[model samples]
Target: MSDAAAYACDNVSTPVEAVQAVLARDDLTPAQKQEIAQGFSARGLEFDVSEQVCVDQG
Candidate 1:
């Protein structure tokens, strides 16, 4: 099985989880990451690591 496929099967239970798992892998190239991200987008899941999810309120 491909690394992406294996990662998706073993780690992802939701769209966010899928994106997080793919982004965390060092084994995949930029192209591979884009492909995985596109796959997730096609299924109505979108992820952008540049967007901040947590902010300091202080």
Candidate 2:
């Protein structure tokens, strides 16, 4: 694995943070954003969507 991946794998227990980081970036497509949002919703956590819970940068 790449160094970054290796380090994250060893350190970050919650991969959702990394996924959310990617989602926040403008590089992700709308479909990707939707998928991430849905996945987060499915986790049964109370999400403050207006608080930029995941893909929302605005």
TM-score of 1: 0.46
Which segments of model 2 are wrong by more than 4 Å?
1-13, 46-58
For model 2, give the 10-residue run with minimal summed lDDT: 42-51
Task: Give a tens-digit lDDT track for model 1, residues 1-58.
Answer: 9999888776556757757877768787766776776666745357543322577899
The superposed Cα distance between candidate 1 and the true structure at residue 19, in angstroms, equals 2.5
What is the overall TM-score of model 2 with all chains considered together? 0.35
lDDT string for model 2 (22-54, tens) is 567777777777777667653433222223446
In candidate 1, position 6 carries an lDDT of: 89
Clashing residue pair totals per candidate (backbone < 3 A): 0, 0
